[model samples]
Target: MEENKNKVVELLKQYMSTPENEPSRGISYLKEAVFILNGQGKTLAAHEILEKELRKFHDNSTVEMAILLNMMIKLSALVGDFAGAVEYSRRAQAICEAKNERELLTKVIINTSGLYFKMKDYDKALMHANKALQMAKRNGDEINAACCLNNIAIIHENGETGESGIPYLEEAVKIKEKHGMNAELPSSYVNLAELYYESERKAEAAELLEKARTIAKANENEYAIVEAMKYEARFLKGEGDLASAINLLEEVREYHQENGNKTELLGVLNDISSVYELMGDSKEALNTFKQITELSRSIFKEEQARSIAQLESSFEAREKLREINDLAEQNKRLRTVNEEISEKNNELQEMKAKLEEINRLLEKQAETDPLTGLLNHRKMKSVLDSEISRAERYETPLTMIMLDLDDFKSINDCYGHLKGDELLAAIGKLIRSSIRKNDFAFRYGGEEFLILLPSADMQRTTEVYSRLKESLREHLEIAVSFSAGAKQWKGESSDEFISIVDKLLYEAKAKGKDRLETSEAAI
Candidate 1:
């Protein structure tokens, strides 16, 4: 390795020392140096060397220069300087267009589309990807065309079209398989598996996922292996093996965290949190949520710093241009620079807005029950505390009800878990629609629910229960009923109040199912 590094250093020096008029002569040296550095996993070092040396030959528009810029584009993207990568891509693209270099131009367009995809500008990404696909097809570049198809499918999968991109991915996979493109098969298989899973084709998803894993293992492709594991973890969770799912995700989380992959780490942490929630470990879930929030803030800060650095670089370049131009041209250049600055500012604002939106969604997801779409028990405590305080302050009537589905276990046994889940979802929807806007409902636990009705007396609470029962029978096909307990608050602790209502529910269940027992009736 030491010998290889020394040789790379020598090659870079030779490339830098080559005369400006013979830029093509230096291209071999630069390419050799890059190849060596990449083998050593020192791409950042290679990028720095090339970027510093290339400064002296800015006037050269040779194919060599375009090649160097393209290399820099890939390096910048790898280092997470997407804005810089895009700038390099634009420069290379201009040279390719001017020279009518069709092959290199297609490659540059494909790379630009990938950069835009990373930047989350899906419209521009899709546009450039399609353009590259057309060019690749026209040139009979089957491999590049297959890659373009994969990229286009990914864009559609993530974009606002609400389309799964299954068709595009299928075509890409077929082409690669026909050509025996083993190097590319793993990724295509993984992508197709994800789409199949989303489309509810679990059997196909499992087959493709296994194929992806096997091929990735054979190729020693660590990235594809990890990707396959993530989906495997998801399948495990869906199968009710929460412990196995958590174990798989913990491995993925450690890998991403060690690699400093914040985006992938966030995803792993989210999956872990979900598994913890499923296991009824709210403490661990909450801790994971805190980690996610901290990591998200860290990513946002880094992005802001990168944007500021780019703006500073842009300012320096414009200053240099102003120094060379006449007064009139300088004025025109300043106007252009101001416009660019405005656009960048707008972009920053948009990024901030997006980050805020993501945080909002994360908070919502943490509080929500995934199966029933109701507030989960983790969110219930805080809401109950707040409502209790409000009721005390305003001297308003407050009531609580506990409802448990009658023979829910039998339902799960008679009709598989999927049918049980569907029934639960239907019941949750009915409960939500039956309650007043001011009332709060929660999926307290398996086969159980809790409703808090503020400013409602015992009679009103009973009426709400009656309405829910009626709605369930009217809306559901299967015969379903619940035993419920209702009570008006008597200035007791929240826990004590809940316990009393729970006992009342048991009393109703003891007497007969599908009935409501109220404090007023007992009195």
Candidate 2:
């Protein structure tokens, strides 16, 4: 490790000393250093170096900048910053498209597909993956073609179709093996093993898993090794070898934790929890669940911090630009005071527009739930209060629905909180699309949502509920149902209104879930 660190330091020094005009040469050195650092499991270090170097290149359209941005996208995704990765990918995609850099564009598209995959947007993921595959095939880029195939296969595997990805993955593995792509072999093998296991071809699955482990070990690919082990542990658990599965998962968890790979660590912890549950160790399972929750929160907080840092950096850049403009105005004052005033006014207008845009983004951030993209609890109270006031004053009917996911805890317990979050996000999108423009939806809290409909009584509100149910049935990949309580406002305070609806929601759950409960009396 020390030797690798020294090698990285030397490479970075060489890169820094390279002439500014020869950016390609400098980027080559930087890439080498990054490769070494990432191989050492120092991905954060690699990202930091890339970010520092990226700031030196002001022209985003440059090939060097696009390459650096692509690297950042991958590292950000690895570190569980899907939002940041998507932002970087968009910039990279724009640059590549404008420059007609198909090579970089293919990379960007594939990486974007990966980001969507991690976020569980299977439809988009599949779309992008297939697009990248076509592009790769057109360019006769065998390696990228194989990668695209692998991505597509995984998307199909995890998607709602319950279709086997064996064909796609088999093609990918064959391509890699034919090309002697040893580094890529293990992942393909492991993925194939998973499909084999799911198909109940246990012998083939075990053989593929062992091959993956052996190849990964020979390649000294720590990530691939742990990935292979993860699946092996799953197979062990499925075979009822609970003790061995737990031990293997613990080892996998240690590796992810040591590498600061929080995303994979979350998966490891979830697997551990599942194993414990299988072992009938409820106490241990709950403890593991708590750990997953805390780790998820930590990852969320880190992403938030990075966002704030980016905002601060943007503000600082604008401030510097303003200072430079002011200095130019002072120099131009000798020529004409009016001209200076006019230019200064124009600059002020630009600054005002920028500030307003920033304020809009900040406001949205404050009001929206990060996971679900719905109005959060922070905005819920004020919006509800205002709507209630409007309804009372105009004598228009207003209805609110409080809905909770049925068997949400079991979903979380069975599939982990990450899957639960995906379900909630899907439901949030469904609710948004199901409601009218005048209606409002908020992620009231965990596994619960609130919707407010203006100029609508219980009947209209029930219609909205029916629409949501139908939408969920058509769009959702998983089987999920929500119980809701809808009630017409009765000239009461917002708190009273919400309380009444909450009680009805509980009544729906008590009367056997997956149905709507509403006040039967007329307004």
Candidate 3:
């Protein structure tokens, strides 16, 4: 490593002096130097090196688009420049999209989605992660899929949305193990350990952290090694080993200092301060806090200087231009303002566009039943109308299932609306969990949700309906039961198709409320 570093520096010095080496040797030397700096934990210096290289070779073919963008991603992430990271990821994504590089696209999406996560925008994170997951599966890129799953798990965990993330993390771990990705296992273990910790499984967390530490040390992964040490220090602190924790934190700080990881070193300083405070070493704690304050003040002053320079530049630009011209120019400006006012008046007369948009979205949402969060009658009709046309045009099988909660009104009357709503939501969750990619559920009417399964034959539809029924029976403890009436697509209008299932649904409700019924033939 020392030899490689010396050779890289020599190449950089050589390339800097010669114009001919600018494209090849210069870029190569810069890349190698950047890697070496990163290994030495000089992240900011490494970032500066890459930035200069990028500027020098703005359109050089020697530097691949993917490589440049990836460097940007890493540097921006290290500097906490999330917006810049997102922008670079977008550029990478556009290139990937143009080339149909699905795997690379997935990776870019994951990186972009991480920006949303850092900003505490879970919905957007989930959206991008899910999209990446779909694309990864389509491209059969298991590594990308695993990465997507892990990211989704992180979002879910942070959002505290039950245990939805557990399965995703578990699947990612399984994939990593199967693929012999030993280097990635430490991160997976750390994430899994966090999950176990949140789930109140301290023993499991401890065991996983131990495994993580072992692998990290064996691999000489400094970042993961610091994380493991931090985790162990935390564990010791929790166990009331204050002195031991302090010793570990100090040792870790020394390790990071040797590794040139200033950020981690500062973090360890903070940890040591906390431990000292807990141990009644007020002088040591105060000194540590003072150091942190000094660093913070230095950063703030740098930012203030930057802001002042930007303000001066803006002032110069303003001074270079005329604010207002002669009387004729002022008159012309007044006329233009009058014209804009007239346009605004005309727009106001047309409609309250923002209010109208909000109303339209609300109306669409209202067509969803509140309890089950499925489409109500109006929306279901709209969907059925579209699906009917699609089925006929493509000559593909489209199945409809009209599911009614049996004795639902009685249950609502007996258990009251709260438990009734719970039952409905639980069933809705079940349907959402059970459906295929092409299938959807909509609350057709009171206590009735309609399921639309495109490209499903009679047998497949029947099997799905059966599984749904069984799932509800096994999962729901409430007195509510569901009866479903199913039908395959025929050359019929939307209303006629729905009537067929409705008739069968009534038949099931009349005979018994917990059974399935289907049309023998299409209309």
Highest-scoring model, TM-score: 2
**lDDT tens digits, residue span 1-523, model 3:** 5775687688678657767644665566566666666654556666666755565654453324655566667565544445556656767776776777667667778776766776567888889999999989988899888888989988977763322366688899899888977777888888887666644457999999989898878866666776777767866765679988987787787776665344446567788887888788999899989976764565446446645654555555556444434354658878689779999998896678777888978986877777777667777676677767767765767898988887788898888988887887888889987785346688776678889886677887888888887788788897457788898977878888888888888888777678888855422
Model 2 steric clash pairs: none
For each candidate, the alpha-carbon lDDT, in order, equals 0.81, 0.85, 0.73
Off by over 4 Å in 2: 1-3, 19-21, 315-523
Per-residue CA lDDT of model 2 for 271-305, tens digit only, reads: 99989997999999999999999998988998888
lDDT of 1 by residue, 1-523 (tens): 6788799889978977988677688877987898677544455576677767666666678777887788777666555566667778988999999998988888888888877887688999999999999999999988788888999989977874433366688989999998988768888888888776654467999999999999878866565677788889988887789998898899888766654555667778999998999799999999999999998787667657867866766757779767756465548878788889999999999999999999989998998898899999998888788778878876767899999999989888989899999999999898998775456899999989999987677877878888898889888987888998888888889898888899889888987889998754552
Weakest 10 consecutive residues of candidate 1 by summed lDDT: 38-47
Q: Give Cα distance to truth, residue 381, candidate 3, Å.
A: 30
Model 3 score (lDDT): 0.73
lDDT of 1: 0.81
Ranking by lDDT: 2, 1, 3
Answer with 2 or 3, whichever has the higher TM-score.
2
**C-alpha RMSD for every candidate:** 16.1, 15.5, 13.0
